[model samples]
Target: MSRIPVLTPETATPAQAEIFAKTVAKFGKNPLLMSTMTNSPAMMNSYLTLFQNLTDGRFDKKLARKIGLAIGEENGCEYCISLLAAIAKLQKLTDEDIELARHGKSTDAKEEALLTFVLLLVRHKGDLTNAEVQAVKDAGWSDEDVSEVFGHLILNFLTNYFWKVARTDIDFPVLRLYDQSKIARGNH
Candidate 1:
C-alpha cells in the first residue's frame, strides 16, 4: 500500500500530465515515481530537468544506466532497482552488466572508475576524498563528466528519498535488491 496516491494522466494537473506524457514517450510508460511526484510541482520539474540534462549529457546511455543500477543497489531502493533494471534492459544492458553494476564494478575500466566514485560518494554522503576525485579524472573523465555524474547522483537521491517518504507503488518489473551491508557481515 503506497502512502501517497499515484496520479495518472487523467487525474493529474496539466503540468503534471505533461511530465507523464513525456515519460511515456521516452520510457513507454509513466512510472509511478513521477506520478507520485505530482504532489510537488517543483520536485517534478527539477527531476525532469535533471533527467533531461543527464540523458543528453556526456555519459553514454549505457554508462548512465549502469550508474543508475549501482545507485539503486547502493540505496537498497526496491522501486528504483526495478525501475532502472527495466530501463537498462530497454537500453540493451545484459544481466551480467546489471549484476556488475550492482556490485559497483564494470568490465570497462572507465565505467568502473565512475562506479567506484559513485559508490564512495553514496557511502560517504558526497564527502569524496581528493584522491578519489583524482582517480575518476585519471580514468579519462573530465570535470564536466564529474558534474554530470553529480546530476545523476542527485536524481537517484531524489528518487530514493521520494520512495522512502511517499512509498509509491512500484510500477516496473519486480526486481530484488541485495543488502550490501548484510553481505559484508556474511549473513547473505
Candidate 2:
C-alpha cells in the first residue's frame, strides 16, 4: 500500500483530470508516480512540464535513463530505480549496462565522466569544487551539458525524495539497490 493515494481519472479534480489527459496523450497512460502526485496539481504540473522539457534537453533518452539510474541508486529509491530500469530495458540497455549505470559507471569515457560527476553532485549535495567541474569539461562535456546534468539531478532529486515520502508502490518491475549476484552469494 502507498502512503499516498494514487488518483485515477474518475477520482481526480478538474485540474488533475486535465493533467491526466495530457499524461495519457504523452505516455498512453498515467503512471503510478504521476497519479500519486495528483495530490498537488501545481506540483504535478510542474513535474510534467519539467519532464517534457528534459526529454527535449541535451541528453538523449538513453543517457538520461543512465543518469536517473545513478541518482536513483545513490538515493536508494527503489521506485525510481525500478522505473528507470524498465525504461532502460526498453531502450535496449543490457543487464550489465544497467548494473554499471546504477554504479555511476559507463563504458564510454565521456559518459563515465558525466556519471561520476553526477554521483559527486549527489554525494556532495551539489557543492562540487572547481576542479571537479573542470574534470568533466576536460572529458569533452561542454558547459551546457554540465548545466543540463544539474537539471537532471534536480528532476531526479524531486522524484527520489517524493518516493521516499510517498512510499509509492513500485508499478514497474522491482529493481533492488544491491547487486543480485552479491545477494545470491550472501554478500549483500
Candidate 3:
C-alpha cells in the first residue's frame, strides 16, 4: 500500500494539477509516481523540470531508457522497472533490448558503455576511482555523457528512494528482473 493517497490532477492543488497535466503530456498518463508526487507541487515541478532537461537535451533515448532500466534493476525497485520498461516499449525498444538493458549489457557499443558506467554506481555504491572514470571515456563517451549519467542517476534515485520509503502499490504491471533481488531506483 502507498503511504500516501495518489491524487489525480482534478483533485490536486492548482500547481500540482498543472504539473499532472505536464506529466500526462510527457508520459501519456499520469503514472502512480506522478499521482503520488501531487502531494507536493514543488516536487512535481522539480521532477518535471529535471525530466525535461534530461530528455530535451542530446540524450539518446535508447541509452536513456537502458540507463533507467539498469538503475531500477540494480537498485531493486519493481515499480521503476515496470514503468521504465513500459516507457521503453513506447519508444520502440524490443523485448530483447529491454532484457539486455536490465543487466546493463547491450549489443550497441555506446549503450553498453553508458550502462556500464551507470551500473558501476549501483554495484559499488557510488564509489568511483579515477581509473574507472577514464575507462568510460576510453569507451568513447564524452565528459558531457558522464555528466548526464549523473543527472539520470539522480532522477533514478528519487524514485528508488520513494519506493523504499513508501512501499507504494505496484501500478504498472510489474517488470520483475529474473532475480528477486528487487528493483527501483525510484517508484517510477
Candidate 4:
C-alpha cells in the first residue's frame, strides 16, 4: 500500500481528472507516479506540465530516460527506477543497457561519462568541483549540453524524491521483474 492515499480519477478534480485522462490516453494507463502526484492536484498539474513541456520534443528521450534511471538508482528509488525503465524500454533501450545503467555501468563511452557525472552530482548533492565539470566538458559535451544535463538532474531529483516520500507501488511490468537482490543491495 502507498504511504499516502492516491487520488483516483473518480475523486480527482476536473483538472486532475483531465491530467489522468491525458496520461491514460498518451501512455495507455495512468502511471503510478501520476497517482502519487495526485496528493496535491496543483502541484501534480505543475509537475505534469513541466514534464510534458521540458521533455516534449527537446531532448533524446532514450538518453533522458537513461539519465533518469541512473539518478533513480543512485537515490535508491525503486519506484522511479521502474518508471524510467519502462520509458527506456519504450525508447528501445535494451534490457541489458537498462540493467547496466541502473547498476552504474554503461558500455557506451558517452553514457558512461554521463552516468559518472550524474552519480557524482547525486553523491555530492550538486556540489560539483571544477575538475568534475571540466571532465564532462572534455568528454565532448558543450556548455549548453552541460546546462541541459543539470536540468535533467533537477527533473529526476524531483520525481525520485517524490517516489521516496510517496512510497508509490510498482505497477509497471518491467519494474515488477526487478531483481530483489539488486534492489536490496542498492546495486541497481
Candidate 5:
C-alpha cells in the first residue's frame, strides 16, 4: 500500500487530472509512480518537466534508461529498480545490459565511464571533487554530458526517495534484486 493515495483520472482534482493527462500523453499511461506523485501536483509537474527535458537531451534513450537503473540500484529503491528495468526492456536493453547497468557498469568503455561517474555522484551525495569531474571528461564525456548526468541524478533521486517514503505497490513485473524487507529497512 502507498503511504500516499494514488490518484486516478476520475478521482483526481482538475490540477491533478491535467497532470495525468500530460503524463498519459508522454508515457501512454499514468504509472503508479506518477499517480502517487499527484499527491502533490507541484511534485508531479516538476518530475514530468525534468523527465521530458532529459529525454530530449543529448544522451540516447538506452543510456538514459541505464542511468535510471544505476541510480535506482544505488538508492536501493525496489519500486524504482523494477520500474526502470521495465523501461529498460522497452528500450531493448538485454538482460546482461540491464544487470550491468544495475551495478553501474557497461560493456562499452565510454558508457561504463559515464555509469561510474553517475554512481560516484550518488555515493558521494553529489560532493564530487574537481578531479572527479575531469576524470569523466578524460573518459570522453563533454561538459554537456556531465550536466545531463546531474539532471538525471536529480530526477532519479527524487523518484527513488519518493518510493522509499511512499512504499507504493509494485505495479510492474517485480525485479527483486535483494530482500524487500531489507531494502525497506535501509539495509541495502
Candidate 6:
C-alpha cells in the first residue's frame, strides 16, 4: 500500500483532471506520478508539461529510459527502477542491457561513460569535478549530449523523489537484477 494516497482522476481538481485526461490521451494511461500530484495542481501541470516536452520525440526514448533506470538504481528507488525497467523492455532493450544499466554498467563504452557521469552527478548532487565532466567529454559526448543526459537525470530524480515521499507501489514487473533479499536486509 502507498503511504500517501494516490489521487484518482475523479478526486482531482479541475487542473489535475485536465492534466490527467491529457496524460491518458497521450500515454494511454495516467502515469502513477501524475496520480500522486493531486495535492498541487499547478505543480502537476508544470511537471506534466516538462515531461511531455522532454520526451517529445527528439532523442532515443530507449536510451533515456535506460538512463532513468540506472539513476533509479543508484538512488535505490524501487518503484522508479521497476517502472523504468519495464519501459526499457517495452522499448526493446535486451534483458542483459536492462540488467547492466540497472546496475550502472553497460557493454557500450559510451553508455557506460554516460551512466558513470550520471552516477557521479547524482552521488554529489551536481557538485561534479572537472575530471568527471572531462571523462564524459572524452567518451565522445558533446556538451549538448551531456545536457540532454542531465535532463533525463533530473526527470528520474523528480520521479524517484516523489516515489520516496509517496511510498508508491510498484506497478511494473520487478527487474531480475534487483535482489529483494538485499533490499529487505537494508530496510529500504
Most accurate candidate by TM-score: 5
TM-score of each: 0.89, 0.92, 0.90, 0.85, 0.93, 0.87
RMSD of 6: 2.7
> Which lDDT tens digits does candidate 3 get at residues 43-134?
77888889889988667787788898898888887778898888899899999999999989999887787788899977898798998888
Q: Write out the backbone clash pairs for model 3.
A: 76-182, 76-183, 76-184, 77-183, 77-184, 78-183, 159-186, 159-187, 160-185, 160-186
CA displacement after TM-score superposition, residue 53 of candidate 2 (Å): 1.0
Candidate 6: regions farther than 4 A off: 176-188
Clashes of 2: 0
Model 4 clashes, total count: 0
Ranking by lDDT: 5, 2, 1, 3, 6, 4
Q: Which digits, one per residue and each the tens of the lDDT, describe model 5 over residues 1-188? A: 77789888879999999999999999889889889998899988999999989989999999998999999888888888888888888989999999999998999999999999999999998899989888899999998899889899999999998888877789898888654563757433
Better of 1 and 3 by lDDT: 1
What's the distance in Å from true for residue 99, model 6?
0.7
lDDT score at residue 7, model 5, on the 0-100 scale? 86
Tens digits of lDDT, candidate 6, 1-188: 66666879677778778778877887678766658865677777666677776787345787787788888887767877788877788888998988888877888898889888888888898999899999999999888888877678767888777776776666677553365552453345
Cα displacement (angstroms), candidate 5, residue 50, comes to 0.7
Q: Which residue runs does candidate 2 get wrong by more than 4 Å?
A: 179-188
lDDT of 1 by residue, 113-141 (tens): 99999999999999988999999999998
Best by lDDT: 5
Global Cα lDDT for candidate 4: 0.76
lDDT (tens digit, per residue) of candidate 4 on 17-69: 87787677666888777776866777777776666765864457877888888
Off by over 4 Å in 1: 180-188
Q: Candidate 2 lDDT (Cα, whole model)? A: 0.87
lDDT of 6: 0.76
For model 5 the local lDDT of residue 81 reads 84
Error of 1 at 171 (Å): 1.7
Clashing pairs in 4: none
Clashing pairs in 5: none
